[model samples]
Target: MEILKRPMGDYQTNCYIVKIDDKEIIIDPGMGATEWVMANVKNPIAILNTHGHFDHVWSNSELQSQLNIPLYSPKGDIVLMQSSTWMPELPPSTPDIAVDGDKTLDISGIEVKFHHFPGHCPGCSMIEIGDAIFSGDFLFEGSIGRWDFPYSNAESMRESLQKFAKWTIDKPLYPGHGNPTSVRAEQRNVDYWLRIV
Candidate 1:
């Protein structure tokens, strides 16, 4: 498996392209991501979003049209995707598949899992592919996603942290912002986030 990451937009949101064998999966095609993704992918199979935040999914419709691939988004953020919650200029993108909480599917023979961890947004989740987990805005390097934004809930974040505490399987975590970390690495900090958040 090959993973390529490039930060996009003013927010510097991380957009990832995960390649396994001949097929590639695009994760979180944020603002100004279309050009980079177009250059990087060959056999693009599907577009996956961990959550539906303006900065995280700004280039969704553009890429979907260009690549002509299926889009899989968490069910909870459908509203956020279809409507401009944060940025009014946000281009509305619709998902071909709406992933309910913590569901896994076979995307062209590859196991793709969506681990629902709502806190930053209603449909906030982490996309798990192979040994890597694309944590959209859930778990960062040392800090967790803020629950201060609209549609964000502090209680949900706390619950998600509690749920994460029990996650025994550790994998490399690629967050929406900043550098990468591991599930185990962030797990150790979950307690701190739980206390403060």
Candidate 2:
């Protein structure tokens, strides 16, 4: 398996491309990825989104259209996906597959799992493949996601953090922003946040 990270848009959102054998799956095709993907990827089978924030879904429609692949996103953040009061205009495309809870799916021959961790956004989620996890806005290297947005809930984030702390502590963590980290590292880094009420 090969994982490529491309930073896109003003936020430098991380767009991850997971390639296993001949099949490729894109995670968060943010702005400026259409051209890149067109020139680079091969045999893209599907798109897996962690959430619906603009920075994460900006190029989703274009990429999906161009690649002619299906897009899977959490059904919890449909409001943010449809319209964001703060972000620039975006192309709207309904998610081809909506994940509302923890589930495993097979894209062609690759197995991907989704875990809902609503906090930064109502539909915040993470995708696990092999020993790595694509942690959207839910958890970062040394910080967690912001719960001050419109549909965000602090309590939910805290609960998610606690839940995350209980998971296996040795897998690599690929977050939405910044460089990659690990579950054990994040468990230690996020200790302070978990202490909050």
Candidate 3:
């Protein structure tokens, strides 16, 4: 598995392209980088959004239309996904699959597991592919996600953090922002946020 990171949009959100077996799976197609992603990868299987934030799903509709691929997201975030004020102009291709709890999908022979973890947003999820997990806004390098947004909940964020701490796999965490980190490192250093609440 290969992971490609591109900084996109006004927030410089990290758009990730995971390639395996000549098929590409785009995560958080932030903005305006659709051509860049398509040019680099062969056949795109689908677009997967960890959450429906403006910064994460900006290019989703465009990319999905261009590639004629499905879009996958959690079921609980449809409200956020439909907000025009938060998102740019989108196409009619909403998420074809709405995942709940833990579900796995095999895309072109590569397996990707979805883990529902809401805090930053009501339906935020993490994608586990190979040895890396795309944590979105839930867990960052040394800090946790902010819970000040309308859909964000402080208690939920704390619970999600604890859930993450219990995971046995110590894979590298590819968050929606900042540098990448390992699960073990986060577990050891994340006490700062966990202890406060």
The lDDT leader among the candidates is 1
In terms of lDDT, model 1 sits at: 0.93
- The TM-score leader among the candidates is 1
lDDT of 1 by residue, 50-167 (tens): 8998888899999999989999999999889877846899999999999999998999999998999998888999988999999999999988898998899999999999999999
- Clashing residue pairs in candidate 3 are none
Candidate 3 per-residue lDDT over residues 1-197, each given as its tens digit: 88999988788889999988788899998777787788877888988989888788877778877889889988877777776565546533378888776789886678889998888888889999998899898878887778888888888878887887788888999999989998898888656777765
For candidate 2, the lDDT comes to 0.87
What are the lDDT scores of the predictions, listed in order?
A: 0.93, 0.87, 0.83
Q: Order of all candidates by TM-score, from best down to worst?
A: 1, 2, 3
Deviation (Å) of 122 in candidate 1: 1.0
Per-model C-alpha RMSD: 0.8, 1.2, 1.7
* TM-score list, all predictions: 0.98, 0.96, 0.93
RMSD of 2: 1.2
Evaluated at residue 76, the lDDT of candidate 2 is 92
When summed lDDT is taken over every stretch of 10 residues in candidate 2, the lowest stretch is: 188-197
